[model samples]
Target chain A: MSLPPPAARPRRAPLALRVAAHEDLGGGLRWLTLAAPDVAAAAEPGQFAHVRCGGGLGPDGALGTRRAYSLADADPDRGTVSLLYRVWGRGSVWLSQRRPGEVLDVLAPLGTPFRLDPHRTPVFVAGGTGVAPFIFLARRARQKGLRPLAFVGARTAAELAGGEFLAAAGAEVAVATDDGTAGFAGTVVDLVVRALEETAAAGGLAGPSPALYACGPHAMMAALAAACAAHGWPLQVSLETPMACGIGICLSCTVPGPRGPGFYRRCCVEGPVFDAREVAWE
Target chain B: MSDLTTRLGPLTLRNPVLLASGTAGFGRELAEYLDLAGLGGIIVKGTSPSPWYGNPGPRTVETPSGLINSIGLENPGLRHFLEEDLPWLRTQGATVIVNVVGRTVEEYAAVAEGLAGADGVAALELNISCPNVKAGGIQFGHDPRLAAEVTRAVKAACGRPLFVKLSPNAPDVPAVAEAVLEAGADGLSLINTYLALAIDVARLRPVLPSVFGGLSGPAIKPLALRWVWEAHARFRVPIIGMGGIREWSDAAEFLLAGAQAVAVGTASFTEPRTAAFVVEGLRKWLDERGFATVGEVVGLAHRAIDGEEAVPLGQS
Candidate 1:
């Protein structure tokens, strides 16, 4: 399925906006809805927002590093953008404490957005808060009249996010959890692999090979990359790294190329999303 | 109207605010949010003779008021940069300071020589302070002899004014400063990132893969100011001060501390328009303070205290 592009807002400097809403998503997770028309108007699937906590990440809210988070959803008409993140460090913790109406500085809709040709099926594999871009992808796919299949996993059922959106998008939703408190009792990657095999065996789909879209721990993404390679599947992976600025200026999120290229690439620019083949999973 | 203009050796900048090397990443990255040509200069990422991939992952971590990073001077070789990046940089309309680093003195000279006649390049900034690499970087800055040798070699190859950036970790920073000045350094930029490390309490291992990394940001400003003050108090050379400069006051502090100009480094990562903001803010500050030129503030602090401000402390 093919859909029209989102409303275009010419790229400008990051804007400061007020938080319209905030919600806790199970343990250590947060959902922040920001009142940023510019960001929402320009957001594309798989692109992320560089979020700066109003207070620093240090004790007493000292100015710590500004961190990046993937956009979970963006409503241009509503003038809003949303992000889903897990509290891993001071930055996230500070973000979690933000209240509605509090101003937040953000650089948005950055990096190469994930590409899913309408001719191919998009199989989204996510772990924990990695569900961020997957949810956006699912919703966007639905808008295009295509239904993607998503494998959502977490430590337990309590930690899952956005599976309902996958179902609403008409996707075949598969859930897994480490503690077997969800649909499947294993890793989401295994569930995705089995599902792909079943679809292929049933000879039940039309057009190009199914494309795999995944965002999770490096280990999980690396595993998915290898699985996709072994089965000759097209895979696009979203990456996460400790970064200062989400823009390309900071070399903080640099990584070597997949095949030992001599120089480094800024993950914030060259990608927060990359073809699995371009990544040096090793 | 306040004039932000200041001179570094032969180059006259429109403002005293320079985008420190490595922070601007070739100038185009920050250009997305700013007018690149508006800055006094952009010290491009430190380049070597050949490409360097830098350290393995987990290269940076955030500490209180500072960011610790070990990027290992990852950059393309001189030839590739000249062929690809320099032309685009030329179009940015900013004074381009090509910062060169190497494991050997000849490598530095070769890279400097490569940019000598390059269109759009204004000068060369020799980075002898990177702590991640093994062979040379900080080693050259730590010894007066090695610092002098690198300066002389690059000077011999390039006719452009040479600015050797000094490391705060030098064994004798003032001595290193004097040696480089004596060896024909047209100007200097001080101080580079300080050697620091962090421990992952849970894992009981060093945070960065390199074991130790350069500590930058507001945390290192005091040390940088001290070094710049010390070097300026003793030498006649123009010094560009930088270390954790995040605001106009920080840049102004450096100027009053004896620096002719200031470079915004890690602060650029924190805010893309920091250098430009500092420039604008400095103009407001100087105008309100009734100063005529940025040069008037250079070495002003040295004139304030009695001649006894220099109780020399051992260099890091």
Candidate 2:
């Protein structure tokens, strides 16, 4: 049967309203705060908002596509949210150019969110822009009175958008930079490994492993996964793909996983998040 | 009532409208925006014998009125398809034309061999036109002999109909089309992306990592129609016309210009529902014109032209 004539779907409650946008946290990266009116009723960590960067296309009448960015901050009761992104190309550059008072089209509370382990200790691993989602996850962890560790990596200290926010959320935050312009001189994995060694030496009361939640470049995620595997730590990773339609329709966001014999999953629908063990990293 | 259905050789399409590979992916994403089942058929993204990593960062760039893509034919490979994507696609209820690209005649044969018995796979559209890869693409497409060899190999390996997708970059597209037809290709999809490029001013670098990418969208429509008309005139095999077809009017031009079917590409990047929209528009057009069938319009241009020595229309 032919699909019902194309109609706009408006079933979702607005989780956030665009409150402000400006040059912040350094070059090519912009911070936009959205006010989520409904989140106060019920907001969960690990959920994201899909924003339609209004100027996504060029001047010659191209369709402006939408992108799914991590919600950096959210207040369920206050009905506010935040997002941080780097202006990589046209779509992102268009998003950064938006001004305050202009409501960007947004689809919120998407993807399989970060699931907190009730018994296991939580560890947050993020790389640069990948750090966006962890801010909320860390905040939610603290709200539930859970202590989490956040290890962040960037090219330098200036690129770290919400380091203070993570610390305020009570995460034992560690920083890593490719250039020795920040806390750790190497990668976040190096900091993580060093932290593990120190914890091991102290005969830590926390178990030998931590439940790892990571989001970053495939290389960083894979490295973190391998590190967690070596130490026998369970890990979850938020993967990225070039998504055309943020809905399940465009299989363009397909990712190879180790689940079934021919395991493939859509990042838009199945998850922007998955258990690291189940994902076939590529 | 108009008969929107048409035939490309033995394969019967519900209408003249079809979705181009790569641009449409599977029909699922587009189905959300428009009714996919209402269209003629769906040609999936280029598949291969093995999963390909494609190219690195900077694969796609938006040019003025068009797009340059160097996606390098990134796909999950054949094994993943036979086991995963195909089964799911079959449930959608459209003619599933699997677009396959090969690095060698043998690999093309191997992939065609595998798909020969695969369920839900109606035909194989050999993508000999991809410009991103250094191996087994434009090389075969530009040269008539290699195009014939690859077509013959795939034809021998698969019992299903074969549609050789030709590149516009070649000087003599009609010659290449004829060779493929002689080699047993049942049909043809004319005009894959033309070789093109874009520059990044901010980084002072090439917009795409490959430096040169294949151009598609409205920019290449006229050229694609020329090739389709020329190839259709020279060869008996049915031609699937594409490139820069964004709307119903463009699709109508291809049909009146003698295309057996029309594939909507680049437009899908901007408007996911463009294919279904075109299909609906074509059906209404036929009904209003009081034509009984879409086939009546195919090669209709040949009848009207004062001269017919395989000349391209809309040219001085």
List per-model TM-scores for chain B: 0.95, 0.94
DockQ category of candidate 2 = incorrect
Clashes of each: 1, 13
- Candidate 1 structure quality by residue, lDDT tens digits, A194-234: 88888788885565568889998888888889999999999
DockQ of candidate model 1: 0.42
Candidate 2, DockQ to 2 decimals?
0.15
Please list the residue runs of candidate 1 whose C-alpha ends up more than 4 Å from where it truly belongs after superposition. Answer: A1-11, A54-62, A206-208, A260-263, B307-316
Q: Score candidate 1 by TM-score against the native.
A: 0.94
Across A1-282, the per-residue lDDT of candidate 2 in tens digits comes to 643233332223223356554546665677787655664335456666666554433334433345778777787666677787888766677777777876765666667777888677788888888878888888888877778899999888777656777887678888999897989899888888788778878886274357889888889988888888888888888888766545654344667776544366767677888888878765
| Weakest ten-residue segment in model 2 chain A by summed lDDT | A6-15
Q: Candidate 1 residues B9-63, lDDT tens each? A: 7978888889898888887778776676778888899999888888886888888
Please give the DockQ score of every candidate, comma-separated. 0.42, 0.15
lDDT, candidates in the order shown: 0.83, 0.77
lDDT of 2 at B307: 66
